[model samples]
Target: MPNIDATVTIPADATFDNTLQALRRSPLDFVSNLVQTHDDDIVRLPFGTQDIYLLNHPDFIRDVFVTKSSYFAKRKDISAEGSYLQQMSGVLPLFEGQLSTTYAPIMTEAAVNAHMRWDTMHQQRDFLKVDIYKEVMQITLDIVFKTLFKVDMQAKAADLVDAIITMDVGYGFDPIAALLNDLAPPVTVSMTSEAQAAHSYLLNFMLGLVEASRSAPLDSRSLFSWLLKQQVNGQPISDEQIADQALKIIFSMHEVTATTLSWVWYLLAEYPNVEAQLHTELTNILAGRTPTFEDLPYLPYTEMVLKEVRRLYPSVWIVGRFVRDNISFGRYLVPAGSIVVFSQYLMHRDHRYFVDPDQFDPLRWTQEAQAARPEFSYFPFSAGPRQCAGRDFAPTKDALVLATLAQHWQARLAPNQTLEPYPQKSFTPRYGIQMTLHRR
Candidate 1:
């Protein structure tokens, strides 16, 4: 493997210090700046003893995520180890297969039920002002709980949501922390007290569900029941393992989907033309009725809008992998033990791939246009074998939710508020999106 040339390195001097400060202040902006400043497909950053390589081009991204995927592992030293879905990598096939089938109908029902709830609320008033993120989060939480555990979680929704939020804050990524971990011997990153408490609450909650399922009649459709049936070697998986898996699944399902849907609402409010076009399609197709999974195929524009939103504000904005072996991008070598990262944020907005990249245009997702772009250029769910387990489930739910909501109501951004993307555990709206809903 050949050494990377000086041109690819982001110099570790005053400029690097300034870049680190920029990173601490705003990681998204830091990455965006890096993309704009560096022309190379692979840019190297010096972090302590470790070299961090940012893969900018789709070809390089394809090599890391697909072709030479065996040479890399999820970077446990950074935040990848904390990822619930990543931790459950082995069961990804089950999620893609059996769990997807079980989840689809539940997701549709939940979407319809949410629409009905909004309908009941709309009866008292023609318009309502609400925080759209909170509204979407609650809906997604309910859907995840019912689908995963066959339990209605509405009553416990408030506390559960709080717990998740606390955990997110506790587990928020810090590059400095990561650098320290990289330089020092391996150690567990301690969660904040509040986050630990939240973790315990969630763990206990899942454990209770797992224990209850032990005595309850086994349902082939239930995720827990299915897990209980599985044997590792000759022994059945323990309650603790089942509970942990359930907790991870619940967290991954709700948070990512809710964040994505929240962005959809905010983006729609900001781009009325796109929203109008979406409403037109929904009206033409569903005719003021709720959408079902079957109706999603005919709702191409609705799907396009969701795709566009994801492209702009992907829930999982950044992915990191630890290089296990020397990997080459042409003549340049990314040495073993270095961290390789790719940003969906930067790739989706690259000028070479997307014309007027900042614009919220659903037309870019048309089959013809999509076919013209590199397959790795717009992966909001990441890519290859390790792509999101809920890839199929999420889009269907989002389209149905958006279609159902758009058929009857329009959400407008409230006046006098700045909308910014805060890249936390997920790309979240820094200030929650406040919107006024009108009867459409």
Candidate 2:
């Protein structure tokens, strides 16, 4: 048994009313402040009858995700019937071994097509001034759609984008509700009418695609077609199962990559020095041509820029898992039935692992610099077996998209607007990024 002497629990009484007040104000800021103020590696926050333990050290994070992963459950109430999200999460692991081999060629083709589409848009002056976040979101939606279903979704992009945003807002995390649910099992949470509509529209949209594929000749290259042909216990998978996986893939591919690419443009505009280095590298490497999968190995600096953006603003900033059994971190014992949460936002910004953590420096990702830091100190896509299934695909897509656009144009931030990070399902800009594109 492990000793619990070193564990520190923040009281729930009036003395720490400020913590509760801060939490009400902004959960992200509250968690950040709590981690910084306490020196302990593990800090527990008591709410009602349960405790939420924040793991602040890298080793503890490793233990939760790697060393003792089986002792943690991804969802708090695993015994309950799995929701759509739960079903998606449970099914993702089945595709991990096949993602890189099956999707790399499709991603590369999509990236080249994205380049051609942008070139045509630029010729028509449509890329001159626009909301880049929305633009990238649409681009990613099209790319992911083609990659998954081998069909063009450009015609329905507008409706799909609207539905996606609605779904995000509708299903976005609510801390207060989460706390209540943990304190009391199976809380009946409600969604807005808009969210309900979005939910129905997205589900129907996916179902329609699945239905259409049943009669169409199967594309040897499409993930959707491949999934449709998959068998379990010698039986083909169900339409609902395929639809759920497709929806999950859409969210993973579109939202995360779009948010990262949006930040990439914003950061490049903010730091001309890094942008200059990137341009020089791209010019030297590709000489004004669209990049391919083969060009990736030569574009190390470009990858570094994407890495820095991921470090500064990870799409999935925080991840939480429920402790399945008593777990020990050094001398501290974390009891079963508690939620153990870790923040990539906090770990990436930690001063111990990074020098001037807030500064956007791509050189920090240099092999030498990376070797000097602890392995778990920087995990934007997370680590271990449960890491994102698209971990290999997202960066490749982001790099290609970034290389394609930056090769011919530079985005300048539009005048008179403040950019703030909104801690949504993905860390998105509260007000979308507005910019004017200048030909290079």
Candidate 3:
């Protein structure tokens, strides 16, 4: 359209520097403001040749993540400049297609349907519902354990609960590994004690996981085991490959699931009416019992709530890609090598598609309402090929956790404490959310 290759330089002046500073201070709010301020699909950053193109509009998002997905691949390494932050959150080289193919059946809508049926009829016994946030966190941890290690770490759960609490602690925010991933081989830090500590901790932890998996007998259910059994033209996966994949799975699952659950409680507390309606739906459907996969079809309200939470606070809020070649979509062309971002936070909040976009209304997800909107307008887990591999399991687990906890308890935010959303590893509460659980 309008000179696709025409690019402008973003200087290291106050405008650019201050913006970066603001982002470091409050990334989510900063990005939200960025979305509102910039109209250009792509803006050149002082950072480098890799421009920051905002993919907030659904039409544009569909073009980037779905329609023209093959044109973009996950950025080889995220940050252009060297920083500790980018390393921690960089693209992980995990087994992609095989992992997706293996888990697809288990995480499918049908599998969810079957699991819910079994859960509702038989498996909900002895299940005293805990706080929804705690329950989801536990379930994610369980899933990670089963899928990654093929073993439940719960035998040591109580002790290990805090062990991995801040597993990514060494690299501050995004981690240096994520930043320098595509650069030269991993380098040692000589600057701060913090950096050194983080490097040591993560390296050791990864090494241990690798050693344990290698020594242990293979288990079919675990992801590591699945990888071990696989041969790429009769060659086994390398130790480094195994460790990297394991780290990716662990990091992705824990932070995202925990943060999503945190927002779930926050939203439920903010909207008493929605909570009441959700309770009514769950109670009417399950009749004072835990929800199962079968009840998912009947539990639209629960699904809506989870969808709403995701809309407001997507675990993987931003999808990043580096363009491999110039691509034309709609009226514009995104040149090769541009760093494109498709943001769920921006897309979900855009006024173009949603009515009263800022408000959190779960009812919009009702079959009738959803049917009325553009298909690509709703994408918390993204859309198309590179959409989250774990997207399918996330909602079912969220629904189960929410329904189970809501069945017996109502959790309320602690008095006089204001909790705001901020992006750390995931969408975490800027200040930790304190809640007092009242038994219902």
lDDT (0 to 1) per candidate:
0.76, 0.76, 0.60
Q: Local error of candidate 2 at 408, Å?
A: 1.1
Clashing pairs in 2: none
In candidate 1, which residue pairs get closer than 3 Å at backbone N, Cα or C atoms, i.e. clash? none
Q: Is candidate 1 or candidate 3 better by TM-score?
A: 1
User: At residue 44, what lDDT does model 1 achieve?
Assistant: 84
Ten contiguous residues with the weakest lDDT in model 2: 178-187
Tens digits of per-residue lDDT, candidate 2, 1-440, equal 54554555664442334544555468688788777877786778764455778888889888877999888866566654134245446446443544455555655555566556666777896557777887788778877786657778877876888787776666644554443334323434567789889878888899899999888988766667667876666899899888887887787667677889899899999999999999999999999887776788999999999999999999787777778888888788788887778888889999989999999999999999999988889888877756776677688788877887788788899999889876754678767788987788
TM-score of each: 0.85, 0.85, 0.75
**Model 1: CA > 4 A from native:** 1-24, 75-90, 98-102, 170-200, 226-242
For model 3, give the 10-residue run with minimal summed lDDT. Answer: 84-93
TM-score of 1: 0.85
Candidate 2 lDDT at 150 equals: 73
Q: Please tell me which predicted candidate would have the highest lDDT against the true structure.
A: 2
